[model samples]
Structures are given as structure tokens and as C-alpha cells.
Target: MASVVWYVCLAGLLVAVSGQIVDDCVLVGGEKKSDVDVAILAKLAPLKNKRFEAKVEEGSDTYVYTFVVCGRVITNNTSTNEGLLQTKVNSKDSSVIGRINETHVISGSDWILLSYRGGDKYDSHCGSEPRTAMIMISCTKNTLADGFMVIKEERSKSTECFYLFEMDSSVACPPEESHLSAGSILLIVFAVLVALYLIGGFVYQRFVVGAKGMEQFPNITFWQEFGNLVADGCDFVCRSRPRSADTAYRGVGDDQLAEEPEERDDHLLPM
Candidate 1:
């Protein structure tokens, strides 16, 4: 399985490198036609909502800059500033392509490549630098990698590209919110536990408790025990009630005689 994944990723990276736009691409109206790549970018227009991260070095220090798609602001931690920010984002589409020494802009059927200067730092002035830097993003159907990005020289060779990890199928990218939040997940788990308890109790009463193996406890039925409890409670509540002299009591329960007083004796009996 691991080998299969590795090969798929390799193929995807190769595809990304091969699709580098030697020209620029743009959108005029709604139609799209690229010079060299697939429709990957067009399909993932939603990428604008996602954030991507990569490490860049400035002098002797390395900082992680997270790029916000379709937005100009780059930050070390995805904010406008810890102390600095990136300028406006420059966006182009598959409809137009440009090729020049200062910048190489190309649009292909599936990919777009831009080689410009000064997207190198998270500082505000970094956007104004006049040095060449290129970024190429291309999508793939490979199970191992949803896409790959080129951050080095324009039309970067296969060795210079980085394949991205697989994407979430339900979401276009990793969501800012967890797929499953801790609180809601815990509530679902608790509900499942309660359901299981009720089911187990029912099964025990209907089958396990009354199976042939339970003959040893035949006198312990639920209703019988419950009736005995109710009778005991009633006796306790009525313990102080007056009793007639004619009634015999034993073990705190009245025991009526089978024989009744004779007709003559009944007439002389006092209430």
C-alpha cells in the first residue's frame, strides 16, 4: 500500500513540473483556454478560501509564512502582522499568458505559472522587491496528492516541485474548524452510551436473565420483587393505625381467624 502511494505521488509531481506555464494566463469574461496545462486551477477556484504554508529564509533566520489564497496578506502565523504584512495579491487566470525576461507569465489548459519579484518575505516591502521568484500550483487526481506547488525558479523541473498531501474529500481543503469538534463529538459518544445501556438492559431482561441458566434464581422475577417492595412500604406507612381487639396480629401483619363469632356471641361482642 505504501509503495502504491509513493508511485502515485511521484507521477503527480512529474505532471506538475511538466505543466509549468512558460507564458501568462488570464480571464477575460468567463471563458478559459490555457496554453499548456489541465483545468486544475479552474476547478479549484475555491482554493482562494484556503491557506497554504511554506518556510522561507531571510538572512540567517527562517520564518514560516502562510499564504492566504486570493489575498495579498502573508503572515508568519496567518495574520496581518506579528509586526508586518504582505501587500495586495496579484491574480491572473487561464485566459491570458505573458512571457518576458523580468517575469514569465503563462497560462495552459490546466496550469498557470508566474515568475515575478519580491513575494519572498513576510514584510510589507517584500512585495516591492525586484528579484525573480516563481509560484506554480497545479491540481492532480492522484490519491496520494491532490496537487503540488512550485516555489523555486519558473518552469521548475521535477526536482524542484513539492507535492501537497491529499485533500479532504468533503472539503476542498483542511478546514479552519475541526472536522469533528471535541464538544459535539463527546455529546454523540454520550448518546451512544445511553442507547447501549438501554439495549443491554432490555436484552438481559428478555433473554439472558430468563434463559435456562437462570433456573437457580427463579423466585427473583422483577415484578414479584417490585410487588413485595410496595407491600412493605404500605405496611410501614400504616404501622401506627389502630387495630381491633378481635383481630390477631403476628409478625406485624394481621391474621384473620377462619371461623367467625357465633350468632349469639356476635350479638354480645363490643365494637
Candidate 2:
């Protein structure tokens, strides 16, 4: 049982190492290009689980190539040859053409190149070097009708005995930079300031001043006074204007004066 567990752990470790795309596909710009890599990976995540196959003819040989991006290709293996990118079927019936890149060497710039070394050897047409597979990633804003296509199944005069695969996908596009507008920045700053003011005030009142209940509010009195002042100002501006004094009160009539009563009082005093 312990040995079985150990074997299982080893298998899992091998799977992880073989499936690691980041280690196999290094970014062109290193650390600074990490964001671009992340963005591209996120967009390509849909393709992570999907594998593509295409049939192409090179010279007299016709081959069906199978591959995936940032992932491994799993299929029925008729031969002992093993690789993520391989020829599933070929007219020559050689099991596999050759493992173009078996070591999974990292290469490419804006475009990503995944190459691995170590596999079966190619015929004299190419060389005695071990076969390898190379998958190149290219980005497109357009839709992905097909995932990957065979670029060259066999070695060219200038190139070595390796299989080349290329893919065009929207996932390779750079992410659009999003920035906050001036108004948004100002609004956020204002909200943060208000929150800080209230929180600071509450903490100070609750602990420093030993306040309880509603009194724990910071500058509670000042805020209340400010609210009242604001209400008063609004009322003063919106309420109806007062009537003029001339329209509010009427003048007294001269005929109603009390001068005769003073004269009668003086005469009574003299008598």
C-alpha cells in the first residue's frame, strides 16, 4: 500500500511537470512582460482543455497532427513514441514522425514558441538528431475558427528535423488598459475622506472621550450643527418672501384722536 501511494505521487508529479506551460513557454520580455503573459493565458484558458488536429501534406507524406495550447495533447498512442505535440496518423505508418521538441525549450516574443527535445530520430532526409516538436502561438482579434494548423511536418532545407505548429487566437492580444477618469478619482477621494473622518471621529469619541451610544460619533455636535445650518440656508432661499410694511399695516385716522379728553381734564382741575 505504501508503495502504491508512492507510485501515485510520482505519477502526479510527472503529470504536473509535463503540463506546466509557464515553465515550458517563457515570456519574451521576462518580468515586465508577465502581465501580457497573464492576459494572454487568461484569454487562452478556453483552449486549455481543447485539443486541435489538422491534416496536411508534405512532399509525398500526409500526416494528421494533434496539439493544444498551454496544455498537453492526449490521444490513443499506437507507437511507443510520447509527446504533447505528435502526429496521430501518417501515411508512412511510422507511428510518430518524430518528437520535434522533446525538451520543451521556451522561445518566442509577442508570439510564443513551445519546443521540446528527446524522442525518436528522423530519417536521413532530415538528420540523425532526435525528433522534436515546436508549437508557435500567434494572437488575433478575429474569432478562432480553427485552433492550430500544421506549418511544416518535415524538416526544411534551412531548418532541422522538427515539426512546426502555429496557432492564431484572440488570447494573444494585449489587454486594454483601463484607467479612472478625473471625476471618478475625485469622487473616490471624497468618499474615502468622509469615511476616514467619521471612523476617526468615532474611535476618538468612543475610546479617548469615554463616550457611549450615539455620543461615540466623532464631531457629532459639529455635524448636527452643520446639518441644521444647511437646512436653514435652504429654507431661506426657497421660502416665500415677506410682505412689505406698507401693505401689512394701515395708517390711523385723525378723527379718532384723544385731544378733547386732555382739555376737559385741565378744565376740571382749574375748577
For model 1, state the Cα shift of residue 147 in Å.
7.1
lDDT of 2 by residue, 137-168 (tens): 77666755256777775666543767777787
**Can you give the TM-score per candidate against the true fold?**
0.25, 0.46
Clashes per model (N, Cα, C within 3 A)? 19, 14
Best by lDDT: 2
1-271 in candidate 1: lDDT tens per residue?
6534433454355436533321122222223433222233332333433554544454765444333323333334643211111222232211111112223334333344433332232223334222233445443333322333223322233222221212222212211336788898999999999788766766665576664534323344775789999998998788876465455645543445456766666767788
Cα RMSD for candidate 2? 12.4
Q: How many backbone clashes does candidate 2 have?
A: 14
Worst 10 residues of 2 by lDDT: 98-107
What stretches of model 2 exceed 4 Å from their correct place?
1-64, 68-171, 243-271
